[model samples]
Each structure stands twice: as C-alpha cells, then as structure tokens.
Target: MDRHKVYISSTYRDLADYRARVINFFLSGKMPDSFSLISMEGYVADDIQPSDKCVEDVAKCDIYILIVAKRYGFIPPDTTKNPGRFSITEMEYETAVSHNKIILTFLADEKQVFEEDSDPDAALLAEKKQKLLAFKEKVRLAKLTHPDGFTDAYHLCFQVQQAIFNKFFTEIYASREENLDKIYFCDRRSQNYTFQKGRQINKAIQFFLINSHEKDMAHFFVKRIGLECIESDIRTLDLFIYPTILDNSDFDDLEFSMRCAIKEEWNRNAELKKFKLKDPLDVSVEKVLSVMDELNYDCLIISWEIKSFYWKNDKLNENISAFYEKYDQVNATLKTSKKIFFIGTVSYSECADMTFAQFEDKIKSIRYGATPIKLTRINRNEIKDWMTDFEIEDNPNVQEKLLHDLLPGPDPDFYLSDLELPLRNILMKL
Candidate 1:
C-alpha cells in the first residue's frame, strides 16, 4: 500500500492536546494502510509557523485534515490575491484545495471550544469571531469535506477515522465493476419499480414537489441504482444532470448552460466523475429521440434542476412548455434504457400542499395533459426499515443504534422537509 502523507491544519494553543491525540493515533498504526503525518507540532515550532512553509507542506500531502474551533489563529501578510489576508491555518487549507488534496474537516461544537480569553476587548474579540465565522463558512462552502461536528477529541478521532475508511477503503472494496448477470440481486433491489425511492425518481424525472432537498434524495437513489447497474451486466449506467439554473440571463443556450452549471459541482461529486454523461444540444422531438438511442447505456438517470425555467420570464415559460412537450414524448419513446428520468424541485407548499385531486390538476397543467405520478412521502415504517438497513464496515451494530435512536414515532407521512435535517444528522454519525 502506498503511504499517504496527511497534513493537519489547525490553530495551535487551545487545540494542542487534541493535535497530540491525533498525532498519536497515526503513530500507533491503527490505520488500515500506511500513513505519514505532517503537523506544525512536529516541526520544532510552537507558534512561528510561516504561511509559505505551511502551504508548501500542504501541497506535498496526499490528504488534508482541517479542524475548526473558536479561534481564527494567526494571520499572515497578504499573499496570492487573498483579500485582507487569511490565517496560516486557512492558508494551508486553501493550498490543499488548490493542489487537489483529499480533505476531511471536523468542527468542534461551541460547548467543546472554550475561549481562552474569557474577557478581552469587545471590539478585537468581535473582529476575531467574525473572521472565524467567515473561515468556517469557507470550509462549509468548499464541500471538499462533509464538516462533521465533534464534541471531544475521541469523538473527532472516531469520526475522522470513519470518514477516512468510508471514503477510501470501504468504497474501494464494496464497489467493484461486477457482472450483474452472474450475481443476482434480490427482486426488491432489482432494476424495476419495486424500490420506492428509485421508482419515484425514475417516474417523476423532473419536478420534485418536495418542500426541501430536491436532489438530495434523487442523488441517493441515483447512486443506489448505479450500484444495481454495476451488479448486473444488462446495460451500463449513465447519469446526465442538467445542472441547476441560476437566472434566465445565465442560460447560455441549452447545452452549454447545463455544462457550465455542472462544473461548479463536478469536482465535489466523485460519483459524477464516473458517469458516462452527454450534453443534449437539441430539444426537438426527433433529435431528442436520436440522442436517447441506447448504444451502450442501460440504466440512465437525468436530473435537470429546471425550477428556474419554470418561474423565469414569460419567454422561458413558453420555451419550457415547448421543451417539456418535446422531451415528454422522448420519455415515452425511449425503450432501450431500463430507466431514464428528469427531476425538478420546488417548495412543498408550492406543490404538494394541495389535496391529491388539486395536485393532479396542477400536475396536468405542468405536464401538458399527460398522466401524473404520485409524490413519494416517507412513513414511520419506512424510516424504521431504513434504520434497520443501516450497516457500516467500521461499526456493524450501528443499525441497531440507529433503529433505537433515530426511528421516529409512527407517523403516517413525513414530508421531505421533515426528514432532511434528521437525515443529515444521521450521516454525521457515520
């Protein structure tokens, strides 16, 4: 196994003990593979870490581990076009990002971080807090890491280890390019409409009446279906996401608009890097049919965040009507792929709040007189079933815990808004 060098970036004084524990964790050889650690603590310096030297070390590492606490750390002189300069810790993070290092970030909860200066000048302290907040925002925006929160060194270490193994080893071993014909999946998991989430995404290709998190669930099913496609050699799975539209003016033709929008998320999504994607230039009935020709693709997921187009200027509304009218036929015409879909999203109040009869009318209006599909909502039983299904390589008993702790009361329906935050919290546990 190649020895992956990991760089640790954080403020020094308050985190000194935590940093030591992490260094010891690496030194103890508990990791599945070989790893080398690089930290300022090791470089014979207490607080005199030069920004240039720190970022230089960051560029040399294979992985970057960032810890954010209360302090913003020492700021160095302006460099590399960064306005108002930045802390040495943040500079290291920026360097790691620029060099494309795999980053895992863990944040300390407010209770876990005690301000060393209990009473400082209000103005100076406020300035520091603002800068720290801005830096935390940067970390969250980067999306290079999930930014799991931790309360203590042990919790941080455990989660960091879990994140590392899940991202690298577990993924490497769990996902093999399998020949699905040889290995069979349960009928429930097969390439059919049995999986509720999978079916919802496939049938309702565009427009999720979900109040919150339009594509989060969509992405989940897409990945799950992608796994199914990999298992069976029926047909290669391909995903084409017609990126999120910003404003009408931002729309640069149909094809390039999607491509440009996709670039913003392209680096953050590893699964997307594996997709055999295509850019559709034409929306006409015949050209779309030609484009949908299944040369090698079998299972395909097309998620176009067409929400902007639905509410943009009158011209766009007309264009969208014509566009959906043409592609609606392609949805009916495409026979080669096992699954092909488009999914848009909106506020729950805006879409699914009405009665089913009213919803059907709304759907008919949006879909131009075609048959409508029922919006998927989660129930208590499904949440229980999902918790029961949660299994992790690092912790096999995690499912039991999740079932006991996360399983909600027996509600008949849990809207998308209801479960999104809890779902995120559950992932943090992993």
Candidate 2:
C-alpha cells in the first residue's frame, strides 16, 4: 500500500497530550498502514531554522491536521514578508494552505477552559484565548468542510479516525484515482435521463447537476434521480443537485424536499446511509464557470435540446448562444486533461431540411475542442419501440437507451458514430 504523510499542526505546550493521543491512535493497529503522522516532536535536528523546516515538512505532507486549543503557541520571529505575526503552528497551517494541502481541523470543546487562575500572566492568557477563538471562527467561515469539536483526547481520537476514514473513502476508494472523479451535468431539463446514462458507465462517479430552472422542477428532478440511483442497487454515491433560481421565494421548500428525498432514499441502502448528505447548493447558470473551476471536474457532460440553441432571434435563444460561447471560452482555458462532452438531441417533428445544417453550424461556432455527439432524428414512435424492445418501464431509462442507440456504432446513417467516436473513446478511458 502507498503510504500517506500527515503533518500535525497545533499549539505544542497546550495540545501536547491531545496531539500525542492522535499520533498514537494512528500508530495503533486499528489505523491503516498507509498513513504515517509527522509533527515537530519528531524533528531531531536543531541546526536548521525551525520555521523553515516546519514549512518544508508541511509542503511535503499529503495531509495537514490542525488542532486548535486554548493556547496561541510560541510565536516565531518574523522572517518572511507576511504582516501578521503567526506562531510556529500558524506558520505550518499557512504553509499547508499555500501549498493547497488537504486540511483536517479539530477544535477543542469550548466548555473546557484550559487556562488556569494560577497562571503568572493573566493578560497574556486572555489575549491567547481571544486569538484562539478568532482563529476557530476564521476556520469555521472558510470553504473547507468537516471542522469538528472534541471534548477530550478520547473524543478527539474518535473524531480524527472518523474524519480520516470518510476522507479516504470518498477521495480514494470511491473514485479509484488520486483525486475524486467529479462530473458536472449541465442541463435545463430534468437530468434523470442523463444520470441513467452516466451510471451505465460508472456508478461511482460523483454527480453535480446544475439546473437553470424553477425550484419546484429542480426538486422533482433531484427526487427522481435519487430514487433511480437507490433502486439501481448503487451501494454508495456522492450526488449534489444545485437549482439555479433567481429568487428565494421557494428555496427553503425546495431544500426541504431534496433533503427528505435524500434521507429516505439513502436509508434504503445500508452502505450509503453511513455517509452524510449535504444540502442542495443554490447557484445561477451564470456562475457555472466559477463552479466548474472550483470543483475541478474531471468530466463535464452538457446536454441540451437542439431547438433551444437554434437562431430564433429571440432573447432566450440569444442567451442560449451566449451560454455556449462562455462554455467554449471556459473549455479553451481549461487544461487538456479535462474532458468536455456535448450531447445534442432533436425530435423527429422538430427536424427540418435546414435542421442538420443549422445544428452543425451552431456546434462549429461553440467548438473549442469539445466532443459533440448529435443524436439522430428521434421520434415518439421510435422511443416507444425501443422501450418495448428493451422492456424498460421507466421513461428516463427508455430515453437513456434511445440516446445510447443513437450513438455511433455498426450503423452509420442512422447514428452520428463518426462524431461520437471521440466522446465514446474518452468515456471508455474514464
């Protein structure tokens, strides 16, 4: 097994016992063999600068564990350009943050006051308490999640074990990659169909659906998707649906419905019930690029009705064009390793002599190295036939099967296999 180096950061004098307990917990037989804890106590050399060495160790570590207690720790001399005076512990955290290390923070229980009345410097003690509270508050407000509080060394040990286990499960075991496999599904319509297709490939893929529609519709879609995943026998899945609503009129209700759906569906699966499900993240379509950047998605699957992108000279159609333009720009700026897939479909009734030409031109305009797979003219009769043939009871499953049949294969004229080959190749690699 590949070993992971975890750097421990905390006030040495105040949290020495808690830190020792955490280290010992990992060193015990219960912990996995892949993890090894590192702290300043393990450092034997005195000739090198302590602060520099701390930063170096933090940079090299695979994970950073920060424990916040009552003390502010020993403030090292200001040797760098940073204006704020940070202790050796804070410096280690800053180094970890700068290097973009995975940080796990454990806060000491606020009920227990570590400061003693017999302390020599009362004012200094008060200052340290204020600093510690402020630091804890700062961490709470940060983007990182899972900052837990512990009552004592035993409580801290259990919390540490749980946190590390959850992290390893989601980040490593779930994806079977160095980093989590994040897939962003952008669609104005219900994404249950798209999700069905995605699961057919990799059920373990993390899903983040961005729906630019009404809150009620988003709730309906999320509920449907959750139920489908549950019924499909997926043992564990990380799913998040963000509804892009303009107002907060129905946000609360939508959130409540989504939470209920997740809780109920997840309860049906014993393995999935162990993991905590977060509330639906609300975001606008305009912020899609920012969300993509933040999540660093491995694959982006964008599905849209071909009619929506048609040049109708209407404001909504123009907005759709602008959306693709932004997508093109974002894709151009992204690293080559990031895969972008465009799934375009048109109904048989919506198709015309100029439909193919128009769709081809629109795809070319939005082309920034995105693999475009245009589903051949689909009709109600063909869909019904497919559903009957496959004996699929669900509409979403039928739709997914129909779309899959439209992909390039042995048949050439009926499917755009040439254009879909590249996208299929990428999906296969994933």
Cα RMSD, model 1: 11.5
Per-residue lDDT of model 1, residues 281-388, tens digit only:
332323333343534444444444333213434444344455456555555544433454444333122333344344333334453223322336565555545544
Clashing pairs in 2: 408-417
lDDT of 2 by residue, 182-266 (tens): 1111111224444444432322112232222111123223433433444455321333322121112243543344434434443
What candidate 2 gets wrong by more than 4 Å, as runs, is 42-49, 79-82, 115-127, 143-148, 170-430
RMSD of each: 11.5, 21.5
Local distance difference test, per candidate? Answer: 0.52, 0.47
Poorly placed runs, candidate 1 (over 4 Å): 1-86, 94-169, 172-216, 224-236, 240-244, 250-256, 259-295, 306-320, 329-340, 347-365, 368-380, 386-402, 405-430
